[model samples]
Target chain A: MLSQENRLSFFLSFASLLGVLLIWQFSTLPQASRSPYGIPDGNAEYQRLMGRSAVASTVRSDFPTPGAFARNAIEVLHAPFHNNGPNDRGIGWQLGASLLRVMIGYGLATLVAVPLGFVFGLQPVIQKALNPFVQILRPISPLAWMPIALYTIRDAELCAIFVIFICSLWPILLNTAFGVASIRREWLNVIRTLEVRWPQRLFFVLLPAAAPTILTGMRIGLGVAWLAIVAAEMLVGSSGIGYFVWNQWNNLSLSNVILAVLLIGLAGMALDAALAFVQRSVRYAE
Target chain B: MTLFPFSRRPYAFRAAPCDHGPALACQCGSTYPGIFTTGHENGLPTGAMSAQASVPAISRRHFLGAATGSAALAGLAGLFAPHAAMADTAPSGVVEKPDLNIGFVPISCSAPLIMATAKGFFQSEGLNVQLRKTAGWALIRDKLLDGSLDASHLLSPMPLALSLGLGGNAAQPIRVATMQNINGQAITLALKHWHKRDPRDWKGMTFAIPFQFSMHNLLLRNYLALHGLDPDKDVSLRVTAPPDMVANLKAGNIDGFLGPEPFNQRAVYEEAGFLHVLSADLWDGHPCCAFGTTASFAEKYPNTYRALQRAMIRAAYFMQEPSNRLEAAHIMAQAAYLNQPEIVIEQSLTGHYADGLGVVRDNPRRSGFSPYPYPSMAVWILSQFSRWGYLKENIPLQETAQRIFMIDEVRKQAAALALPAPEDGQNNWPVLTVMGQRFDAFHPPSYSKG
Candidate 1:
């Protein structure tokens, strides 16, 4: 069912990825040969049981090879939804918790941003006046909000939500502002002559025409939201993909971080794909 | 779940001549009714009685009298056993809250808390404890204050600082149920500092401490002050994480750091730095970390709190056993706990370590376990707080120490009231030897003032 051009592009993309993996494996060969911490003391029990050299093994840098990745992927995917108390849980549950937070945070951001964006776009005076505060806050990293949030909110879970809201707010707000502000003057004049009420004109004319730009902003916000959520969760040791990555870092297991990284990438792609679908439905060819 | 979920009644306490029979009796430390497991009446020897000083000397005769009352109690317990068994925390009045979360940082100082979880000490005490590994001291403080964590392993100085409202928001006073570990911290210097080993020569050098309100900072400042160098003027002290200390040292961002083990040993293990001196050398048995909770939490759930105390104190005893050190360290090194390489952890735990100066050191008391939360130690810590300008106001040192650290009799022997003891548990007041100068709890302010 695939088109010729599409199949050719897919083949080329696969070839490029294969080329990268091959290069990565070769570069990490020297790392795998020696222990990352310069010690061969991994399986201390092997010395006690069998008196073998393998007993005092070292952990390699664990730059994941294609084979290692496949093995780890299988192990991680084998039981994706096992819940073990608070500290430890299945990857499925962790992913779910993170996604749920993002959705809530992003949804909350949208509720605030879209309405405010309309106001900013509708009113030039308010937009110019409030521009400085948004400009300053937009460049600030989400993690910078950690201490302040932890202090004021006084809960790790809420702090995470607050962080996500802060990080994802900017893009949606700006895009919606642009979308609402740049609505065709003719469209408004038509609504005006027809004596259409403010609410109807805003909803029917403004929203539909600006839907594409708003969706584009939301897509960018989604990417930034996922990125910020992980970092925030890492700082706060609450349940999230970020917590998983931080916990792995505590164990000095870069391999586990890679696993989390791959999962985050997949989850991110799925989210983007979902938003893109919505974007397309609202999008017009005009 | 059994008809009676044998929890409120700990394994150390029995209901009726022990279900296994008196022949298989254990020296159950205290006398709770229906738990006739002690082989002899005076089973606790003098050495044991010293520890059991906190445990009331409930006579076997009075205990048996209490036991008869327990049979009646058991009949009542059987009536509600099924309902109780379904609940995580006993709906029964004994343990107000059962399922609890205890937090700890990933460090050797958290060995007891970690062991208590791994060894099922928490469960045996009839408590379902979730041992959450927190990220940092400040996070632990926030979590504890916010009541998200029922209890946490805290840096010894943290509760003191928090109670005094020094570093941040206070009014939510924290209490030390018991000291978790002692003397497990050390000063680690970069290999570059190998030549200028003496403290006097280290002028203008930057050093890191785990936290501003940590014993690591206190001890580092004390050491510098003792050597005639002002900690503020002569050297710089930056707050850094334990794991990050080694990386910072390796990066040459810091010349040295005083932090908890096995990070000190980890630095040596990774060849990033050399162990300059163990904290044990400066103060032979200084309190490091404590198992702590909010004062309100301890007051609210007395039984649950008692069970926690029993587990943590027993685990403290278990940690001090020389034979248990290596095995315990290995357990701690697992990904779930300390998460360091086992061998590196073994070096600090077993007291046989490569000091990173091409010499091996063996000192069994490198990390002593001081389970007792002596008020005197807190007095000394208060003096240091004043010396360092953390304590802005002149609060009564003894009063605050007793209020936070001394653990007054109101809640001390929650389960062992059948036995009798003094109100405050600091009878043989600790005579601490800090840097060849004595710190007698009576006047630690003067000792620190110099």
Candidate 2:
């Protein structure tokens, strides 16, 4: 959709990353200049390549060399396609489990949060009555819910979903309530004067009017749901990204752990980006 | 075809000593399957075998008639039940109650848990035993307290530590029903660190231990203090859970760690380190893991407690046999906690463990469990806890020791089969030297004396 020159600028941005990598590569070369780190200075690809090789002098005297790093990188890139490689879990499986939990929990939270938020949104007295309890629970870290969830629910998977539920419900509820309450009184008055039924008024007028704010709340809620799954998995002790990271860490496989972390970050970015795209395309009412 | 299918049968009361239940039955219905039934002669009580030896010579005709009737019934019962019947004629004071979810760390010390399940000891006593593999000793402690687990394979000092309220605010008081296993855990120090300095120069070094307040930590501190190193001020001690210690060492995040077995082997394979020290050398050989239950569990389920103890003794006897290591290793490997290659399992079983100090040359024996319950092990651990500031100044040591070690329960279980009262006795074998000093464990003392 953009001009070629503009696209070229976007592609060229990667050059900076390449440049930093090159500098890193050169600095880590087996022999560059004699720095106090004690790794031999040589141009061989198999030589000291991480620049800081002081610790490598022990067990793995020559690991993380340029060749080793390259091997590790290639191994990481192909990790998704293989079974039980150093970074064995493919992106698809990792992202699917996380996305599945977020969607189900977020959907359930929405079903409850939206209607209650609307009732409170319209009635000032009701909102005031419920505000304190919601406020008390809102700031509690989602991790705090893990023990209660595990002890209460017999199943680990369900407990994880429950944690996601606790984390995401509040934002959507508060936002939807705020969005419904803030709707211009004139819009409701117009619907009333036209003799529209209450359900019809809600369906056709108020919802569309408050859609942007509601979506904003959903966006925030979805993010929280994604965040909560990691913590939930850690507590539940089953198959999930959080457990995967923990298992790898227990095995002392730092590379796999780092790789999982990277995958989590990328998946989170993709999710946020997708939500942003949806928000933009659905922005027609405003 | 379904790999696992189900069949229904009428109510079956297990009526013989050999009836182990369907779960342990071979899928093919073959009587003795691979790694399933070892048929070790440990199920019978130790002294009962000797007492039965004194049975006067009876008439051949009378003996033949008694044996014939029982064998015919055993054959018919074997066809339907396909296992031994529960021993309904259990001696009095044998635990009257027994249904348990027994938590265990998947180590060789847990042989009793496996043997009890295999030998029909629990079933014979009307006990339903569920073995749960836990993350570490700390979780075992927590689960026992919260009733998630009825009992657990616990570190020796756990009962004492719990009673003293050493762990954070939520500490629950506990007592040891029996000493489960001993001397199985070894101290593993990283090879690189070992090469750099002797263990006596332990000052300013960081070591990994399973828990901050565990018995191993206390032992390590005392071992260091004897050599003029203050564990608190001179060394940087990091708490690494057992499962992570091997990897932590391989990755060089930690210099050395003290843990049970196989982890030491993994470190050796990685060429990342060696075990330069061991717990055996520290305290002449000390109490390690024990079976612990909440004081309430002991009170409410005294019958169950006796049954658990009886079963554990059966398991311990199986481990005492030298030939059972191969089978024990296989079982440990299958358990989710120690799921890995058979070699790691084998290495841990043989007690051919090497650590920062040197290779422990002792052949595998039942290192952890006590034949006779020892109260002194408690006093030894308590002194260390006090020394390390985990406990305040010593509070009535002997009374506390009495409360923690459930000798009466062990004695009741032991006497059922007419076995001798389990006394606090040591295998007065050879003495071990650390840093050219020989020490006798007859009276476990602080490191200065050892």
**Each model's number of backbone clashes?**
12, 34
lDDT tens digits by residue: candidate 1, A120-230: 998999999998999999999888899999988989999999998998999999999999999988988899899999889878989999999999999999999999989
What is the lDDT, from 0 to 100, of the residue B220 in candidate 1? 91
Badly placed stretches (over 4 Å) of model 1 are A1-82, A123-133, A196-203, B1-93, B358-360, B407-428, B445-450
lDDT of 2 by residue, A159-247 (tens): 77888888889998999999999888898889889999989988888887777788888889888888888877655533467766665
Candidate 1 C-alpha lDDT tens digits along B1-450: 232122133212212222222322132343233212232222112121112212111111212433344444434434543343323322123766879888999999999998888888777666888888788888998899888899999998888888878875765688888778877788888887765656888789999998887889998998888777899999899998776787788778999999889888877765678777777656656789998898899899877876677677657656765678889978987766777788878878866677665555566657766456767678888988888787878877777777777443222332222221212222424556666566766666454443
- On the 0 to 100 scale, the lDDT of residue B442 in model 2 is 37
Candidate 2 lDDT score at position B421:
21
Q: Candidate 1 chain B — worst ten consecutive residues by lDDT sum? A: B53-62
If chain B of candidate 1 is superposed on the true chain B, what is its TM-score? 0.77
